[model samples]
Target: MVFLSYLFVLPVTLLVAEVALLTGATTLAGVSAVITFGLGLITVPIAAVAQGYHRAPDALSPTTAVVWHLTSQLWDVGDRIALEQRRCRLRSCMQRSDQPFALPRRAVFVFTADPADAHVRGNVTRSRARYLYRLDISDTYGQVFQRGIAVAIAGNVHATVSARRTLTATDVPTP
Candidate 1:
């Protein structure tokens, strides 16, 4: 985070210094400002790549990619934003009806024996599972993944979830 910030701030500050040197606005030496601005501008790309940030994919616009990247990294589950999650038995679960395609969604919730489970989904590489994550979902890529657990899937959401592989609609745990 700090590295990316420095890449931008340093250049702009050098630009100001360059302007000051050219206009004789400050008593600073001219050679130093030119060298600083030249070095900062040249290093921007190297510094950005070194920090592991690059251009967005061809499909997405630059602004959209930036907004999504920021949203995912900034609005985390805790602190200013409170995203609730729980580990249940996954008594019953399904997907949204109006989605465009059938694939495993990014968020999955476990259903316990109760009727009114809170229905909280968590990120994939997340601790959303009770013992072991029986069900894993990745809505961003339009897919659903599951382990060796049985579930009762209802509603048209089932059709969308099984878009790729054949998912068992009745994966109940053995007693």
Candidate 2:
């Protein structure tokens, strides 16, 4: 019975602890204390039942399952947000090329441009069948701005593109 408990219940408890640690749940300190102080009591009975023994173990089982459950939920949420951000970026890029595209409320006017540049012209040609170019402008923030010049070519294509900029303390003055 003791051997069965050690082999089955003991290992399962340890495995749960390992999973919890890997998923950023329980700390090593907590796992160590919980397992050291109570794991035996918790696994012993299950082991005894499997082996037809009448007695349970002396220690309590560590609450590793709870930690694993919570960590899994956190991981799921993080994954969802990441996916959403990617989708939003792609949508923004496409919207910038769409005709009659309006700037997002939070977006400020930076500048304007004609689709005569080689790069702009090419992008328009590639997307011409899909969109009617209305107006192309750059913002003060160096963000590419475009509006729908004609009817919807495909679905709704409205996007703005922004370039990376370095900011200095002089860019913003303290009030």
* Per-residue lDDT of model 2, residues 1-175, tens digit only: 5655457756666777777777777886366547744756544444434432111111111221010000011222122111122223232232232222233222221112322333433332333222212222111122223232211111222222222222233332233
lDDT of 1 at 100: 17
> What lDDT, from 0 to 1, does candidate 1 have?
0.30
> Lowest summed-lDDT stretch of 10 residues in model 1?
64-73
**TM of each candidate vs. truth:** 0.22, 0.19
Worst 10 residues of 2 by lDDT: 64-73
Best by TM-score: 1
What are the lDDT figures for the candidates, one per model? 0.30, 0.30
C-alpha lDDT (0 to 100) for residue 96 of candidate 2: 30
Cα RMSD for predicted model 2: 27.0
TM-score of 1: 0.22
Q: Per-residue error at 86 for model 2, in Å?
A: 77
